[model samples]
Target: MVQARIGERLGLAPATVSEGVKRLVTEGYVEIRGARDVELTEKGHLIAEALVRRHRLAERMLTDILGMAWHLCHEQAEDWEKVMTPEVEEAILAKLEGEPTCPHGNPIPGTSSGIPWSSLEPVAALDAGAGGVLTRLLEDVELDHDVLKFLEEHGLMPGSHLTVMDTAPDGTILLEVQRAGTNPARVALGRNLADNLWVLPAL
Candidate 1:
């Protein structure tokens, strides 16, 4: 129920949210201990809570201390979400003693433990009207130059809008994304790249 509620609040589907819960279970981080509810095991609670802490703190640090625009901070925070170390997170918290939440008003992850959180699925899995912020892109050259160029030229970096237009029978995904103003640019994201790029639902 908690996972489902969080998903609803974030505008993501329950299935997608379940993926995160399942990963936590597989890693011994969460468990189903009763018939009526799911509970985070101690290990699960620590990791999940810590991630929330780091994410919120990072957002606060970026916008409050560094003066990043609200829209501009998501990408940087997304990258930091995966890489924040316990020590680094603590240092940030200590530096900003009164900070308790992200600029978006969500609670921060409480610890800096180096646990990797679950990421959103690829663009290919997305529905036509659904949009999300590109959170991360694994680096590759020969396999990804076209997609990268298309993304860069159109301003489709992490935190940019990614809306699927049409999916080809052969598996190519057509995407429409926002540029500098007004209309969005139309581009085709091939199957390989689409499968690798992960995103969080757009706010």
Candidate 2:
């Protein structure tokens, strides 16, 4: 992701993001590939994988153990991930039965069960009347607390069955969620949110 986008996601000032990126580049964690693009180096990838693994595991621990709401796990996991040691991570993994993904359906790195992106399609691309089981929320979407809360409130979590009801001229997708033992509920999602939602089409 670009520095500007990263700053937006983290709610950091532009100067802070620039300085942080510069420090990362100097430390050999990131590389500037183009005028506005940054890529992680091999060393950076390893560190990122460790952080992501711990973060996802932390989310699982929070939701599965403490019964934390799924929408709240991401923020809490941020603090947990930083303090988790390798031993702590292993303990949590064992306690959680080595779950492959976080509460939001994002895969934990090093879990050896990551899903191939090729097998999924963005919800925005689904035709009206088409339906599928929600598979995951994109990482960027997971960072948006409002979006996460909205999705959770509407029962749009992973494994939920949803159908595309209509697409408005403004690119909003009207959807109907098929909750077990209940009548379907209609919800409208904007293009940005819909684009970040991936689904496994009904077979």
Candidate 3:
């Protein structure tokens, strides 16, 4: 992913995000080949994929079985992802009708199954009407408060359709996003919020 794009999605100040990426490089989780793009190494991919699986399953379990609100699911999933074991994850998947994606519709990476993580564009880059289901949220330790609030309020939770509607000189964006279902409501999102939303283009 591009540094600026990652920063925007994580709602992180550019420098802090850069430092974290640097540490990831030092730790061998990421490889920086040039000024613009970075890719995960094999070990990095393994860890990232595992986290992805945990995240999606947690979202599904929280929303579907536990009667949790969708906006609240991310934080809950974040905590659960840390303690989730492989066996537990498999059980959740089985209970959820073997669904491949989470409540917001982001695909869950399989632990023993093989599916590659695609490099995706952040919401900050797209023009109005450009849309895709959110597959992941970039993790930046110093993410902004406003961005997180916007995400929760607007249903830009993972698996939601993210459409870019505006962009500003300072890198702020305006977006239209919605959940999947008949007559799903569309909401506007500001740049701080948009920057933290990540997505793969729809097929």
Candidate 4:
């Protein structure tokens, strides 16, 4: 994402985001092109992955240990992650017993779990009468609080069984969402939302 969008998501000013990115670039953590483009370097990716792993682990703890609602975990994890130490992370992992994904099914970075992420396709790719397990909420989509809550409220969360009932030309989709212990409900998803979700097809 670009600096401005990153600022928007973080509720920071563009100058503040730019300053941080500048520091990152100087530290060899990122590279910038033109006036607005920034990309993480290999060194940056390693640190980013480590932080993401901790953040996801923190989210899992909020859901699994504290019984926080699934939709609430991400924001809470944002703050909780800053307080987590390596020992704490190890403890959380022990409590989760190697469960590899966050509540939203995004994989924790360090785990050797055999999730075939490459096989997962965007929900927008499925045609009418096709279905799959909702396996992941991509990182970009997770940044939007309203959209995350909407997905959770509509039973579009990871592990829910979803079947495509119909697709309109404008890319709105009608789906039958089958979540555990809940009656199936039809949910309408707009193109933007559908394109962001990932599903693992039935073999």
Quantify all predictions' global Cα lDDT against the true fold. 0.65, 0.88, 0.71, 0.87
Model 1: per-residue Cα lDDT over 43-65, one tens digit each: 87877777666666676679777
Best by TM-score: 2
- Assess the local accuracy of residue 201 in candidate 4 as a C-alpha lDDT between 0 and 100: 90
For each candidate in turn, the TM-score is 0.42, 0.91, 0.56, 0.89
RMSD over all Cα atoms, model 3: 6.8
Superposed by TM-score, candidate 3 places the C-alpha of residue 96 at a distance from the truth, in angstroms, of 1.6
Per-residue lDDT for 101-159 in model 4, tens only? 88888778788753677889888999998899999887777778888888888998888
- Give the lowest summed-lDDT range of ten residues in model 3: 110-119
Evaluated at residue 178, the lDDT of candidate 3 is 70
Point to the candidate with the largest lDDT. Answer: 2
How much is the lDDT of residue 41 in candidate 2? 98
CA shift of 95, model 4, Å: 0.9
Candidate 1 positional error at 152, Å? 26
Which portions of model 4 miss their true places by more than 4 Å? 1-5, 33-36
Candidate 1 residue spans exceeding 4 A from truth = 2-20, 33-36, 97-100, 105-203
RMSD of 2: 1.8
Checking candidate 1 for backbone clashes, the offending pairs are 52-108, 52-109, 53-108, 53-109, 54-109, 86-112
Residue-level lDDT for 115 in candidate 2: 62
Which lDDT value does model 2 have at 36? Answer: 69
